[model samples]
Target chain A: MVSTSILPLQLDNVSFEVRGVRLIKDMSLSFPAGPRTAIIGPNGAGKSLFLRLCHGLLKPTSGVISWATTEDLNPSDAQAMVFQRPVMLRRSVAANIDYALKLRRIERSERIHRIDQVLGRAGLHRLKSQPARTLSFGEQQKLALARAWALKPQILFLDEPTASLDPAATHAVEEIIDAIHAEGAHIILTTHDLGQARRLSDEVIFLHRGRMLERTPSPEFFTQPRNDLAQAFVRGELLWWNLGKDNRKNKLKQSN
Target chain B: MNEFSKAVAVAFQLVLGLDHQLIEIVSLSLQISVLAVIIAAFIGLPLGAAIALFRFPGRMAIVVFFNAFMGLPPVVVGLITYLLLSRSGTLGTLGLLFTPTAMIIAQVILVTPIIAALTRQLIEDLWIEYEDQLRSLGAGPGRAITALLWDGRFSLTTAILAGFGRASAEVGAVMIVGGNIDHVTRVMTTAIALEVSKGDLALALGLGIVLLTLSVSVNGAAFLINETARRRQS
Candidate 1:
């Protein structure tokens, strides 16, 4: 399914506005085929909005978003998303995954095989018969991921997948994410947790006030940010204020 | 003994002996209400689902109209059906007036709006929770609606029962349309009304007991089904 035309999904001058407030401003970005990219920003910085726009859940107000794929292959069929709160159908865990596979028109035999594979992979085989809503919060999240993975999409967009989980549950979900990434799907996620961004992402896009201020390798972005806002953000300093007196003095000296 | 006490004694004898007139009246009532509910469901379920899922101009007005129609007075429906089926009236050629068919038509008119309005409320709420997930999975509007309707089957059943309750207890529409013809179109509610006016209080009280039992059973069955669904879900 590797087609040369489909690689490097592109967004050019994408902007989204609600009412009159700009949520994502004139932004052009592209995601390559295989990187796990994390979008990190403070609250209301448009991280989730940007992810939704790229995932085709929301249309951009101004520019073009495209997957340059072969004509026979629809991009949506090859892509999937998991929301932060992990929406599940009012059915059994197995039925939820089966529903997704059925939407793709996978044969019943293949669906049965894939369902078992994903359920066991997500450590949810034991709860296959249980209604999804009856599962705990963490299990619901796991089921959501399992459901998405069952589709075997080429790109997976997750909006704050682990934001609501406890630490132990968070660790479990991270491990599942790592397994998915290792299996060769491009993963893009949004999060405010800096440590999680550093741990899970190879590339980091730091957004501030609805603008992409910096995009760099995760380690370099955390260690030495080129933008002041990103630098302040990484240092755990208050974003609206100067870092400290010493840093302010250094900034003045540099300006002179 | 007072006339009321004497009537009560006759009512008990009629019930215990399973009087044929009482049984016939009860059976016809069940048949008409059940058939009316079935017909209403065929029309109302999809109508409600479409109204809930789709967005168009005048949709809210349509919704409000259905909601208002839920409380439609049975007599008004009876009058309308009566006019339509009357000789020289529209649909007069069918000669359905003073027949069970006309009675069924009136009940359908009364029950449909109730079922459709309740269905809209239930399916709309489910849609809010399931929309994003189904869309992401590439489900179109039809499939999404079907999935919700199936998952909400228990609630939809309750809506149908509510329609049945409305149809079974209604006297005005069926009375005007069916003409309450004995042994032909007479049902429990219409018979009770006729018997009471004629001062045959014994038969009226008998039919009343049967009607009460039927209503209670329908409601009890709905409650049991709802409890089963809730338990299975939990």
Candidate 2:
């Protein structure tokens, strides 16, 4: 189990720009522990980029991303990510997990123990000897999660963990993710699936055009969004055109 | 047609009977080429992996240079090796000129760039697919390169075999550096060249058959390895 110290992540006016085009606008937000947070936005909203930034895969163009943890502990060691399209090494499923543990310098005996545990949890134990690349997309995602889980990370960042999966596969992946979270890893995910965000996340961060428009509890955000854009998004209406006209219409309709 | 048929018949006889002279030449060719490939792999794999993984000033120039060098002429490599090892030249006291070692060195010079260039291409493609995950896993560049090289083992094996093929088939470099000395440094390609020139068509045709068979076998093995790896991946 992870220590309780690395609970919250603080972003102080963090911005990320690539090739002079800003993708993540200057935004200050804090993610406290104990609740799963989901960053939800439309296409090109930089949700994945924001998750990558928080995971330290990309350096912020400016400002700071700080984890509230001890100075001596390397933040990366305590965090892991499962990419939208998880990259599996061309080796056995078991070897993939072993590779992660080996990187962390985990001892061989303990690695075997952890590998067995995570494979069982992810329901991949029976396929441990199969080549990882040969696994189906859903099983590969579970293996990716299992590989990360083997490291015993305190925080796990998942980027659209079930975006490409079918409904059945998505449900299985979600169950595995929930199992990991139950095992004490903080879950931070980005998705465009409103239902998935609502079902899995405790809080929602709604973004539009590289800017954070709303941050609220998932239940409240879906029902009582604070911003016009969030409300439009919740109602499944496009928010990019003629905000003034749309806003007046929405407001009149709400009053009625 | 009759002469060619007779040559073919004689060649088969030589092979089936295990002629000592023919065996000696084939053994020498294999020895020199295999040793050259070993040396080239030792140098080329790391150099290629480094170039693929790191970004530095002049990296593009180096990559382009090595890519072009993949087609380096064997005779030119032989000429350079000759100049280096000839008496009154640099390190002339070593007396390596006209020796099998000199031929091996020439072959290494010719093959290293091919292996390195191919490895660079294979590793670069792999690194693109692997960079995000590896970086997220806290892998430094060296660790990432090591992991990629290991994962790309089958492809690297093909690259090494490519180097071996180039080394084994080349005659210009070995002939020039090795001098085709009888019972000493004579190899298949050089012997074939000598035999053809001396109008010994039967012997030349025999060696030619052996050389062709070896090339086909090497390529067949590479294809098999690639197919097996693909099946495993799928």
Candidate 3:
């Protein structure tokens, strides 16, 4: 633990456009380090895109994002993200963790020690040698978390990490996440689960239609949302449910 | 009256009795094809991975060229190689025109694109599915390719085996470049050609059996690997 508690992230007029369709618009915000920050949005709200930009996976079309940390910080070394649907190399569960540590040039004994701890944390110690692709859906997500957790990233980005898990598995994953936060790793996760956001998030960054609607504390965001969209979203009457899968219906109804 | 019986007896004799010429030809064919496939895989895997993952000028052009080359005529490749290594040509100083080395080179050139193009398609699809996850895990471009390749190893093995099957059965290329020289470049395909030309049906039939059996076994092995990989992925 480097104890760089004062490190915060700044996004200044950030924007990302693909094929002239803006994924994330000109948004400016600062994120204080530590505690879990949840990004909540309806589908297509660019919640995932925002998390990606934060992790430097997608370069901004305009503006800058900087980490205000003392001394030099390698952006590559400072963060890790887990996707909505996890993927693993066609190796054993243990090897996935080992690969991450090896890339960072961690030694064998130390790597093994950390792997044990992470696997145990994720409740995956019993399946260490199992082929990664053979694991159940929830198990794979847990393994993805274990692999990232082993890195001990300064800021962890998660894109709906528990979306597909069963209740028991989801509970187990939440415990691992809580443990990670306890160990002092800052987290920025995107989720559609309002209850999950309320339970785990210290602060909420609410996005709607690629725009940052609010950046309020979780309790305040839920109780007294500043935007109509946020309030409608919290009441579960957002356009997403009305939209459904048929674009024609969605467009016709929303237009009216 | 017993034509089928005779065929069976000949096949049996070819396998049971260690026919010296047949053994030598099979060994040489295996040696050349295995070497060629190994060399091609080493060159092709990374090339294919790069083509799938990277952005560069003319990438689509390069991809199109490789896809076109996958169906390249073995005889044409042999002809070009033969000309290049001939005594009067620029690379003729080494005088390797009718050698096994020339045959290996021909096989490598013929199959490198096959492996690369097939691997590129496989990795391209895998990248779409897993690229975000890879980037999120702190994987650099190199590590991401390594992970994709590792995940797609089963498909890659099948590609390599397909290359081996092509190399082992290719007569036109090896025949032209190796010149079917005895005790040297006389691999199975070229040996079969020579035996048939000489009306030695027994030796040619025997070599045919070996080549057929090898292809079948190689395909069977590839099937097993593919099935296992599919099951794991599911």
> lDDT of each model, Cα atoms only?
0.89, 0.89, 0.85
Clashing pairs in 3: none
> Can you give the TM-score per candidate against the true fold?
0.93, 0.94, 0.91
lDDT of 3 by residue, A1-256 (tens): 5654435888999999999998899999887777689999889899998998988889999989888654555666767888888878878999989988887778999999999999987889999998887898999999998998998887888899899788888887788788888887888889988988998899999897789988889989999988766776887875444444476355445643
Worst 10 residues of 2 chain A by lDDT: A239-248
Give the alpha carbon lDDT tens digit for every residue of A106-199 in model 2: 8999999999999998899999999999999999998999999888888899999998899999998889888888988889999988989998
Stretches > 4 Å off in candidate 1: A1-5, A238-256
Model 3, B1-234: lDDT tens digits are 375557657866987798787788888899889999999999999999989999899999999999999888989999999889998877899888888889999999998999999999999999888877777666766778888888888778888887888888888999899999998999988888888798766777788888999999988978997897778654
TM-score for predicted model 2 compared with the true structure: 0.94
Taking chain A by itself, what TM-score does each prediction score? 0.92, 0.92, 0.90
| Model 2 interface CAPRI class | medium
lDDT string, candidate 1, A108-153, tens digits: 9999999999999999999999999899999999899989889987
Model 3 error, position B160 (Å)? 0.4
Cα error, candidate 3, residue B88 (Å): 2.2
The value of fnat for model 1 is 0.60
Question: DockQ (Cα-based) per candidate?
Answer: 0.64, 0.75, 0.54
